[model samples]
Target: MLGALNMGAFFALVYVAAQLLRTSVAATIMAVSPVAMMLIAWPLLAERPKPLPLAGAGLGLVGVVLLVASGSGGVNPLGVAASAAAMGLSAFGHVLTKRWGATAHVLSVTSWQLVAGGLVLLVAAVLVEGAPPRVGLPAVLGFGYVSVVATALAFSVWFTGLRHLDAGTVGLLGLLNPVTGVLLGTAVAGEVLTGRQLVGLALVLAGVLLGQPALTRRWAARRAARVAEVSPGSADHPGSSTVDSRVPVE
Candidate 1:
């Protein structure tokens, strides 16, 4: 139920923004979805977080800021509003995905949401745009790629993974999107990544990677304890340490 509304809102907003905002601005604004998810999770879910996730959230925000500042173009009030709506709703959807990760059937849940969203988008296209404009071959191909590869194949793997993972873990995987976007922009679209953009990207990557509990700080703790136990002090003492390094420090 929640996924339907959230995913539906995202498709609608993305469609509206593509029409309303410059491509650069639209691209940048899209980065907000992940950050918004983390923020929403902080408030709504009973999930614990680590430094990296927090950092990723901060970096994601920086990316948005840079993207906004890079454009001196007059702000379209509609675009801004639509973008905000998209992120906020997306956050809610992610939280729900996480909440139902173990129990719900990811494929079924996603399928139903896509069906509902597709209908809404179809209706919206008809009402506002009066049918899609005559798309060129390039645009047609692009749409085909989006629908076939991005939507169908991508989500198939995504939802399957969701069924076996926590929300944060799933969210962390999404960090790849922005980085991939930047790379694709550079290679395919000939857009350059500026110094600020690079920094922002680094920060965003760091945050997302750091955010997951799976990549917990326990590693360093375990290593340190192992070193301590094996040090001359412990080895000099009889029966000082029998615990495996994997065990948490009491």
Candidate 2:
């Protein structure tokens, strides 16, 4: 619940700040979330990646660099400050989620966060945004899509996976968001993807593929088998335990 609420708060903060400034600047700031997640994961989650995920993160960094570089224009001080705050807050929340682990109930956490965030947005709409002007058809449609499909549906799929997976693996999957967003935005919004951006995207995808926990797990098993074969009775030894050490204790 803390994780979800923190993410929601971060999003809400960014969205509100965007409204108060330029959309591009706010987006750039939000892009920092992935990088922040990786940094936090290293210390807080003790995420020791073996080449692949780190490479993927590095690739993703290229994409992010391209994103920021491509958007270099009139800088708004207020926008910069707000975006930094949003990024920092979201990153901290991500670390907290990893620290808490997947034992936490996903639905309850998501729901509480949504409810809390929605309430916060409601208050902001009323007080800060000054009643939030009456929505036209387009705005109504946008809001509906954001609330229903983007927020509800995306989170449902994400939370389901999170419950069954390591936080680091889940975090790696986030690399997809930027890639998909860049490609889809280019296609749907008629934005052009430059050659540099394409290269960056490829690197980012490579990193994601490399860092997949499934691959690492498979490799680890293979290594363990080799070790057991070499050591003979190592697994049957009294002190040197297997991966199921927790089972006998529990």
Candidate 3:
């Protein structure tokens, strides 16, 4: 089921949607996945959403909307449906993996999931597309890169993150996908970054920072220290204070 949702259905649907929709439209739609994952993780994993992180996610989502809105193409209902389904399935699968695979080795789990999904996709491909088409060296190289770096290595680290972090935080980190894509386009393809995109980029970075566990822990620690200073005593014994009885007698 994990394999089907994350690897097979998610990838298949994304490919279909990408073919039908403009790049910006498809990417913007995909950017909402962190929110979806947060919602799914709430009920499934009992990871209650934190207000600051949730707000950050929302801010990042709005930033993504602004970032991609400039280049959005005409909407196709089928394409929209496929993109939404891809997002939903991936989010669901991610939460499920976190809940069920808590004790499993990350790489082992990833390997099995990929293998299972690959087999299912292979069978489907044979039936639907008849046979694999011959590819040139560049195409083969691209496939190798995606298979090794993108699928295998990427998923290994992703599962490791799921093990160590709250699902919401991990999901929020996914916002980097679109951010990286836009930056890469600008740097590699010579695409110009507009002012709105620049603002959006800042927001996305801020959101990701807000959702980090280290930042949250620091914020919590500071708040706790301030409360301690204000109260100056334990809640159970409000006015009581501790003193060293071993001091020299006055």
Candidate that scores best on TM-score: 3
- lDDT of all predictions: 0.68, 0.66, 0.87
User: Candidate 3's residue-wise lDDT over 1-250, tens digit each?
Assistant: 9999989888899999998888778877888887888889888988888776888898888888777776434799899999999999999999999999988889888998999889889998999999898999999999999999999999999989999999889888888888888899999999999999989998988888888988888887888887876675754345757555776657
Instruction: For candidate 1, write residues 42-136 as lDDT tens digits.
Output: 66675555455656666765655553345476879899888777766776876776666556676676676778878877787788779677879
Measured by TM-score, how close is model 2 to the native structure? 0.71
Q: TM-score for all predictions?
A: 0.70, 0.71, 0.87
The per-residue C-alpha lDDT of model 2 at residue 201 equals 76
> What ranges in model 3 sit over 4 Å off?
71-73, 221-250
Per-residue lDDT tens digits for candidate 2, residues 50-167, read: 5555566666666655653554457767767767887777667656754664676776766666787777767766776675667899999999998788876777677676556554
> Per-residue lDDT for 25 in model 3?
81
Each model's number of backbone clashes? 6, 2, 0
> What's the candidate order when arranged by decreasing TM-score?
3, 2, 1
For candidate 1, give the lDDT: 0.68
